[model samples]
Target: MNNYNTIVIGGGPAGLACAVKLHKNNVSCLIIEREQYLGGILKQCIHDGFGLQRFKEKLSGPEYAERFVNEVFELNIPFIVNAFVVSIEKKDGYTINVSTVEGIKTYTCENLVLATGCRERTSKQVEIHGSRPKGVYTAGAVQHLVNVDGVIPCKKCVILGSGDIGLIMARRLTLEGVKVEAVYEIMPNPSGLKRNIYQCLVDYDIPLYLSHTVKRTIGYPNLEAVEVMEVDEKLKPIEGTEKIIECDCLIVSVGLIPENELAGRIGVLSDARAKGARCDLDFETNVEHVYTCGNATHVNDLVDYVSESGEVVADAIRDRNDSERKLIDIEVKGRCAYLVPEMIDVNKKNNKRVMYFRSNKILKNATVTMKVDDKEILRRVYANLRPPEMERIVVDYPELSENSKVVFEIEEAK
Candidate 1:
């Protein structure tokens, strides 16, 4: 059994960033990746606009990932690709069982970092009733087919959701000479980034129908058409609003689910709202020494933020000690969708805390307030807030005790 100081799983942007930082700090760490390549989803993301936050330049997905991949290689950081983690055991520290082309191998580490990214929501997950067809695909599947394999899988397509990936594919398919019939979103507003709505859909002259959903897919062996219907505010389809549109493909880009099966297996406490692990200011889960970052923590809007979380994990582990953590709950209320680092570790040396949050619904002139007991600690106002865009903030850790009351609220301004 090979042992190390820390073991970071998933070679995506998060894991790559964590490993690079660990190596720079002279910490022994190893990266285990399931894919043959190390870039994760970025491998097929040929579109530009990534790395603007980290590199201060517009770069393609592969280009941004390549910078970190090159750094990991140049640093000689140990890593194994095409390696899948089968099981994990936590006794004193942690034991990981990985299955690779060679064979099953065991490794041990004092600290574990999960940067497993996320899984795309498929048509089945969204309950789109229809016959099982060949042309129905997730936005990611179509992306890989076109960008990675150079195969145009469809001539005409009806996208079921206005997610970022779906919006991007509308443009991607159009560039490939495939006709994108329209993008149907169940929500009243687009679920993707504002820029994507303009660049991917508006720029391509693609039609976007809000408050609409694909009620059913009509096709034989391959997708031939779909039944789209208007939905009420509650997202229930209207009876007589169904309309048929002929197409060869139905792409679903509803949303992404955090890949947290491993974390669940180990009995880590999860945040229902975040749909991920419940962590503190250090990104350390309820289970001591076990940490999570990136999309594994929550689906992030930007790849740069994912990498930023990896850096947080590295710093957390580097500064970690045997001192007991004083974890206090951060109660979230009001119009916010969710917040990460749900707890505060007042005992940790690092005082600067990074937090991420999203609005539950669209709001203009909204105010966010953070209060400790009856006294307000932080307050910020936003001109506009949308569920599709996540907000990040950095604030100093406030004085906290075991009984200290911490509350975060989002209120819309009149």
Candidate 2:
């Protein structure tokens, strides 16, 4: 088709859920996915623990994704698989040029949803001085190799980041008859969830070395070992704490960066904190009809939140107002790492304003407060707050003018 009411440029869980919701709203939407399949990264995630929030069941990643994929299929939503979006232009509405099996095809849409997801941090990005070798791979790449291709990449591996993927891979490699020596993290705190650390490392009897980092990779054509070092609180390496661990493979799962290159092409303002598009409560970017959701918005820890973001964007597009978007910044003060929907559109009287935020550091008995013009409107006390676990909040914020100051503050209890 040459046109659609909305075009979602990803066939992952976010795009799939977005299309399903859009279809339910009687909106004609089309999905374009670069991968041959619709499941995105979930395809390689074979372990369970997904869908706890959304489905209320412990389902595997594929299972969670399959639910939405089936809905899209049953709803008869239009989708093009293995289609890469070559370029996007905002001529009349939005023009999307996609490269498909048939040929280059052009499609137009009134609204565009970017669900391109996130990319893993590589060895080079983390400044791991190493020679290019076959054994070094990202956690996601190792996942695909083992799960999809049924090929075990290595016999002995040392994971260089206690990220969720690295922790999970530590256990996964063990199950696949590979020896996982240890997981090293540069930060004092684990980068992943507490459950992941317990289930993947603690339960698996794998040790996690905190405040430690891989200093150098001692590998040649294939692989060999890595030199590790301990770091101080400021993350500066301690001189004499260096040690070398022998392992055939090095799995790098330091972190993920949101895929916002497409958003950048359309003059969308970027948020350095969120590492994505600067969006309002409705998930709409500065550019009128362009929207961003899922990991394209930020690296969400759970798949459920990714799907939730998609639904939010779908509903926003359905109930869009013609009134000018009077956007006001939701200033973050103290302890908050970042907050999604950093701005709120006062003109849109959407009672249910959903937001996601994370703590800058671990805090016990933390108090989170929302205020407008120094008038505290909402305040909630959390018994414990951790940086890895993201907190979601829904507020029916009071009506405000364009100049009203909206701020969210977090403070540790005395």
| TM-scores for every candidate against the unseen true structure | 0.98, 0.98
lDDT for model 2 comes to 0.91
lDDT of 1 at 364: 95
lDDT of each: 0.91, 0.91
Candidate 1 residue spans exceeding 4 A from truth:
none
How many pairs collide in each candidate, listed in order?
0, 0
Candidate 2 lDDT, tens digit per residue, 1-414? 689999999988888889999999999999999999998889999999999998899999899999999898888999999899989999899999999989999999999999999999899888788787779999999999999999998999999998899888899999989999999999989999999999999998999999999998997898899999999988988999989899999999989998888889989988889898889988999889999999999889899999999999999999986888878888999899999988888898857688899999899999999898999987999999998999999877888888899899889888
Could you give candidate 1's per-residue lDDT for residues 1-414 as a string of tens digits?
388999999999999999999888888999999999998899999999999988899999999999999999899999999999999999668999999999999999999999999999888788788899889999999999999999999899999899999999999999999999999999899999999999999999999999999998888888889999999989999999989999999999999989999999998887999898889988999888999999999999899999999999998888888988888889999999999889887677536688999999999999998888868877999999999999998866566778888898999887
**Which residue pairs clash within candidate 1?**
none
Query: What TM-score would candidate 2 get against the native?
Result: 0.98
